[model samples]
Target: MTIIETAKMNGVDPLAYLADVLDRNHDHNISRLDELLPWIGHPLP
Candidate 1:
């Protein structure tokens, strides 16, 4: 499960997190998935 807790703990709004990641994460590799994680913000390199 994607930890909604991470979103909360990072002070990121859950809806915003979902929208952001979903909108841009289509091409992301599984090993680099942390880039889209709630705590990481905006698909970091």
Candidate 2:
């Protein structure tokens, strides 16, 4: 829910952002998880 709201606020596609983050979560650095935020994600057009 928050993800959707935040993504909307940032003009991002929530589904794409969530998918990308989930795919990358394993290899992503825990300390930098903030970089993977939905609002900061690069969505496919």
Which regions of candidate 2 deviate over 4 angstroms?
41-45
- Each candidate structure's count of clashing pairs: 0, 0
Writing each residue's lDDT as its tens digit, candidate 1 over 1-45 gives 356677888888877787877877787788987688776666422
Candidate number achieving the greatest lDDT relative to the actual structure: 2
In TM-score terms, candidate 1 sits at 0.64
lDDT of 2 by residue, 3-26 (tens): 788987888877877777788889
Error of 2 at 13 (Å): 0.5
Cα shift from native, residue 20, model 1 (Å):
0.8
